[model samples]
Target: MEHIYLLALVGGGLIGLSATLLLYTLGRIAGICGITFSLFMPQITDKKWRITFILGLVSGAFLIHLLTPIAIPAAPTDNIYLLIIAGLLVGFGTQLGNGCTSGHGICGIARKSPRSIIATITFMAIGFITVFVLRHIWGVI
Candidate 1:
């Protein structure tokens, strides 16, 4: 339990640190969705940094899995159609929100942006409702 808390703190600190560093160095927000979407557009300048940033995220996940992995159960569903729908929904929501949780919750909120605060709150509220409906109402946990 104590170890979990320690890891949480360390992880949060790293997130904040990374956000700060990106703002300082690149004059931009460390939003994963924005960075990732940039890769698809040919006209966008400075693609290298965005690619490196995304790669770093993937590398960090791999490192964590190698070092001290939390036990995540296998996903409950194997349906390809469901997965595709979920992915499309997520992509649409990201666009609608103008950013994902990392952008709004971590970088945006830290910088004290009102829009980020509202977006993060909305994300949390919607997430809670979705989980409640799926687990309790729909019995689909």
Candidate 2:
């Protein structure tokens, strides 16, 4: 139990530290969806930093797995189609919200943006409603 708390603390600290560093060094927000979407659209001036940031994210995850060997939580379902649908929905939702959870809930909120505050609240409410519908009404989760 204490290990779980320690892990959470460490994980959260890393997130905050990374976000702060990105802001101070690059004058950028550490938004995963925004970072990824930049690869698609034309005329991105600073592509290297975005690519490096993404690589660092992936490498960090791999390094953490190598070091700690934590067990990944099992998915709610094993169906490939279900996973695809969920992924697409998430992508669409992020675009609809103008940012993902990381942008709105973490970086934006930390910077005290009003739009981020409202967006985060809306998403969290919708998430709770969706979970209730899935777990209680439909028994999905």
lDDT of each: 0.86, 0.89
TM-score attained by model 1: 0.87
Weakest 10 consecutive residues of candidate 1 by summed lDDT? 68-77
Best by TM-score: 2
Each model's Cα RMSD? 2.1, 1.7
Shift in Å, residue 106, candidate 2: 0.8
Q: Per-residue error at 105 for model 2, in Å?
A: 0.6
- Model 1: residue 11 alpha-carbon error in angstroms: 1.0
TM-score for each model: 0.87, 0.90
- After superposing candidate 2 on the true structure, give the runs of residues whose Cα lies further than 4 Å from its correct spot: 72-76
Candidate 2 has its poorest 10 consecutive residues by lDDT at 71-80
Residue 30 in model 2: lDDT = 92
Model 2 residue 91 distance off true place after TM-score fit, in angstroms: 1.0
